[model samples]
Target chain A: MSARVFINEVAPRDGFQIERDFVPTAAKIALIDDLSPLGFAKIEATSFTSPKAIPNLADAAEVMTGIQRQPGVDYVALIPNEKGVERALACGTDELNFVMSASDSHGRANLRMTANQSLERFEHMVALADGHNVFINASISTAFGCPFEGEVRPERVLEIVARAQARGIQGVTLCDTTGMANPRQVASLCAEALSRYPDMALTLHLHNTRGMGLANAFAGYEVGVMRFDAALGGLGGCPFAPGASGNVCTEDLVHMFEQMGVHTGVDLERLLGVAEQLPTLVGHDVPGQVVKAGTSQRRYPLPDAIG
Target chain B: MSARVFINEVAPRDGFQIERDFVPTAAKIALIDDLSPLGFAKIEATSFTSPKAIPNLADAAEVMTGIQRQPGVDYVALIPNEKGVERALACGTDELNFVMSASDSHGRANLRMTANQSLERFEHMVALADGHNVFINASISTAFGCPFEGEVRPERVLEIVARAQARGIQGVTLCDTTGMANPRQVASLCAEALSRYPDMALTLHLHNTRGMGLANAFAGYEVGVMRFDAALGGLGGCPFAPGASGNVCTEDLVHMFEQMGVHTGVDLERLLGVAEQLPTLVGHDVPGQVVKAGTSQRRYPLPDAIG
Candidate 1:
């Protein structure tokens, strides 16, 4: 049997946050409820950031509290600071995902704080969850490369991981915020990170901006990194990264992994069914290919001339 | 330094053949002329098949004879039979890429011949080029899986390779004609083929229909298969495979390889300049990502808020 992989769906938070129009609170809840039984290891249901910054997900508390959670699936909420952590805890979030940036410029541009400031704030955020029964994950944005500051050194990313670990964060997601990562860099970084912190849950958050998302994910997987963060229909893009595209499509990722004989524990047919509804929900076509073209298992009839 | 890889541009033939409106002969020549100086290892200029079958490429001779060929680039023509060989040789083609399908149903549907029939015809075709100073390659279509008949066994593909070698074919391309291949399957087959016939040139032809194209290419690269067949702006699709999209985008493939530190001889900046013209030439938006999202080296100014 192939080793099973973990997928964390982030469309609701990461994907919806960037939409021009706010996804209605009930629609968000309905979507999460629909996705809960699909066997994802985790679902980032919403973000508890300031409404002024990300108005699309202003209904974070409503989304976190409204969805009927399923057992064995951790419902995660993106928490940016101590107040966000407290809000997520009040909504009974299963996991608190702390957000930061590896590059100081990106940290300042996106979150109005530098890397050091974010790390300093992570301490207070983690402290807010001390008595609560919740998992903590720190997402290091632009860990691969920054749009404002290009070539974020692997050393900087490792340093941030080390700092997050020191703050009692159990997991770290190395994000390619602008889809600037290549497969070789991914393999090297993932291998080094896995070797150094074998106990920590290291997740890969890749974007399809330059079309290297799956390739980078596979590289990470080849180097023993198991968890991945993906969005439905490849939705989500960093507003700061001009001309950038979406997060790696959840269905496409699962389809590729399943086709490669790796177990993703995802019901692909059911997942694709949900993926098909994305365009209607978002009022636009998405960047996903698997939903547009069926899975590899799909067989077509011979051309009419042959038949 | 990373190993140098070969990229064979296939847009002139594989991409243009499927277009609804025939690309004018002069335009075809112009495109090929523009591409010749970009340092492609080989360019499949056009197909020498009967115009009735592929009307879009009716000016195969015009395209082949019109282009100002570069010294380092080999100009290839898709040869379906002895007649194609005769025509390609008349056009002074550097290489003749003979086409065949691995599955009998696909063979009959696409080429009106079974695998055995195509192989038997290869002898006559090879004999036609016996005295000519031209390289010969066989592209095994649907080598990974057939849309009609699913799951093509690895043994069957190997057998076809052996037969092609016996018939004096110098290179073979394992084509996922309809994007049905997975990375694990690609790696395993490529490893086996390379081990058994270390002398023969092997190439991978993938499609992004299901979004595993670059990942499959990387898998093949990891196993030491160095040559790839990509189309400009991800043009080309299998007509027999319903809902299938284009071949892997050439610029995207090159970007990934270059970013990973692998040296592809082609100049990427010049290639992207050509790729940017694809939409105007083809009268449609192309699937390539690198052109839309600049290379990883691209940097953006900090947002107005930060500045």
Candidate 2:
């Protein structure tokens, strides 16, 4: 039997923040309410970043408080810094995810600080969450490769992950922020990281920009990495990377995993129903293919002899 | 060092046949001429099926005779029967691809015969091409799973492939006719087929209806299958399968392989250029993702902040 893999839905936060139009807190909470019972390990409710930086997620506190918490699901929020962490904790978020880039150039563009500054700040945030019951997870953006810096060396990514681990972070996410990851690179990095830090919970946050998102995820799985991040309707892309596409579609990823006998605990039909609502909410067609194509077992009737 | 993989371009035949408007003969010749030098092991130039069945490929003779052939490339023509074999031989085709479905339901729908009758006809077609100095390759459609039959037994597929092999066929293609294959199924089938017929050259013809095309291709590669068939712009879905998508995009497949350090010997930039031209010819936007989102190595300039 295959081991169980975790599907962490990041649509409400990562997917919504990139959209120019504002999704009201009620709709966001409603979607999360519908998604809560679909068997995801976590749902990233919203981001606690500055409203000026990301106007779409200005209702972070409202969304975090508004969602009817599912018994088994963790409601998480993205924390930009200490202020964000304070807001997240006050909102009663079950977990806090902090972002730092592996490359200094990307770090400055995304976080408005160098990699070192972000790493240093994560330590203080960890201390801030010390007394709280909330879990802490750190994400290393551009871990596979960077848009500005081009190919990010594996050593740079390892350093950032190592620092996060040293700070006693519960989980560390290696983000392929620009969708520039390949299977071999992912396999190599995952092998090395898991070999070195066997105890650290490693997750992969991949984008389908170049259509290699699922391919890279499969590679990571081959190396024994279990957790993955995806968004419904293929929403979310790196705002800094030019021409980049959305995150891997959660339904498509779940479809692939379920078909391969990898248990993800996701109800595909219900998840697909949630994904079907994305086009109206996002005000455009989504990048997802599974919704348009249907599942593999969805068969067509036989045509007559003339047809 | 990585082993070299063979890419067979099937857009001219498989892709064009599905379109409503007939591409001009001159345009077809021009596209094939452009594709000839792109380092594909073979180009499926055209099909010799009855015009009533596939009107788009009616100019088979013109297409077979019109192009300038690259020295290392093999120009192939699809033969539907003894009549098609005669036509292909007259056109000086390098190889003849005979197709028969593994399931009788699909065979009747596609070939107007039962599986056994089609296999018997293929044996006759083999004799017809025996002294012509042309190669013979047989394709088993619905080899993975059939849309009508629901689940095609693996034993049925192996029987057809073994019969083809016994007929002195050099290459055999296991076609996922309606994109119904999952990675585990592909891996298992490929492993079993390769183990039984160690000398037979196996190729995978996959579709992306459920978005597992690249994942399935990667699985096949992992199981020691080196040859793959793809359409230029994700064109060519099974006409019989409702809501079906296109063939695995050639550029997407090449991108995955090249990123994983596997060599396909195809120039990606030039292939993308050809793929870009497919929209006008087919009168619709192609399903390929790499053209919209450029190659992983295509780097963007950094922002002004010391980037």
Candidate 3:
């Protein structure tokens, strides 16, 4: 397996979209600018969804156009349809991450469309981005399993992958939307996906809802899946999925990979410094562990009682 | 690798010992009684230490004698010295888990003894249990890394294991006292321990301080170490180590294993029922995720708006 892993910071999009209070437009821009130099392969800057659906990210265009873009980092935006693609292209997004669900029920509940309908929208969206010099990626939500409809078969997920590939998508992120993925299942599905779609850029987006976030990420890493989508301070969760919490924490993931001798290309000190500001940013405690408990290499002074 | 994993519940001993208030004697007994029939291989009922040291568990004797012992379950006690071993034996403890630290600084700070001194005490403690029909296990704290003294070498850990074995210690648990262990280091050390002490019943005791608990346990499992020490609701921490919090959660660990087709012999539904009562019992919310965000098998209803 490869020793180097790619990380996509998704807090700005996945995390901010679920927050109760709307983060100020300037704060969002400042946060993205802070993350730009942190060696992230990509940053999901914002979603160009309708303000009526997700008002938290209503300032998506301001966030996308305001931040100072760092070289070697791709600025990605979540696009639900052709309109989203148009708005994202207008803001000069480096990547367009088209979103859909593997399960029909979730697609309707979340995206207001079924899988086939989403695919049809994707074809038009890809045509809209034809001359924009943007990378097109498809994120298949509930790829592991579904909340309403249980046990999304691997075959169903693969069929969606095949359909996305037929629509000219360059990358695919298998999202365990509600933290329903187990390590064994992740390894099996990721290994099969790697085998079937060798040319596709595969990314694993996981949630820590059941406390298996890092474990699932490790499972995917063991199976040769290199790219991972994590939120800062483990922010962002599926509101539709009850009890759903933070995404896999970005700093925590980097700390684990760096401790394992794998190359994450992240400056841990700088990442942690940014993570320390998350609770204040969100006005609540986040689920991330490493920010509270220092990294493994952290040393504590001997107890004063010790003689 | 074997699919069968043995879980030793350590919430009573580990979790209670660190709480700010002393859990009522009857409450502790009731908790143990609830866990008895849950199909755990062993349960660390309490620690036989001085009342002044761990005031929260001062009623260890009452807790041990009060619970109705279930057949096929081993009730274990953490023994710090000869007096502890005698007290545990008098309470009819099924196992005597001798506690030590691989690093001298932590041993002195936590146990008031160095590794060598703890080993010397273990020899006498094992001798005390010679006539009793009890299993002898030694827990080497900071086997992964020490907070005060970072990077406990693998060879140092092996030497302690060798010494413990020479002293009639039948089982050993390598503890990540402050959650400093990474999966790669865990795999390497656990594989070495399994190879060197094939006859010894090896267990991995991990903390989730840095969010690598399940990942470390999985790494150990991948290398044939089947026994694990976990706390109910992810309670417990090392007071001597700053920023340390929670052991690996018992239900979460079992959930992950059962999801992966590994048999934990634990009735998870019944276990979750017990876990649900943890917050009220502990007087606060716990770090456990599965207890709050139901297992992966949990299914939520679709949004009412979705028609």
Each model's RMSD to truth, in Å? 1.1, 1.5, 1.1
- Model 3: residues with Cα > 4 Å off, grouped in runs: none
- Steric collisions counted per model: 0, 0, 0
Best by DockQ: 1
Candidates ranked by DockQ? 1, 3, 2
User: Candidate 1 vs candidate 2: which has greater TM-score?
Assistant: 1
Local error of candidate 2 at residue A71 (angstroms): 0.7
Interface RMSD of each: 1.2, 1.9, 1.4
Cα-based lDDT at residue A146, candidate 1? 91
What count of clashes does model 2 give?
0
Candidate 3, true inter-chain contacts retained: 0.80
lDDT for each candidate structure: 0.92, 0.88, 0.92
Cα error, candidate 3, residue B150 (Å):
0.5
| Per-residue C-alpha lDDT of model 1 across residues A1-307, encoded as one tens digit per residue | 1277999999999999999888999999999999999999999999999999889989999898899989999999998888898899999999999999999888988888999999999998888799899999999999999987899999889988998899899999999998999989999998999899888899999999999889888888888988999999999998866666799999999999999889998899999999999999989989999988898888888778878
Cα error, candidate 2, residue B256 (Å) = 1.7
Question: What stretches of model 2 exceed 4 Å from their correct place?
Answer: B305-307
DockQ-based CAPRI category assigned to the predicted complex of candidate 1? medium
Model 2 over residues A54-92: C-alpha lDDT tens digits? 999999999999889999999989998999999999988
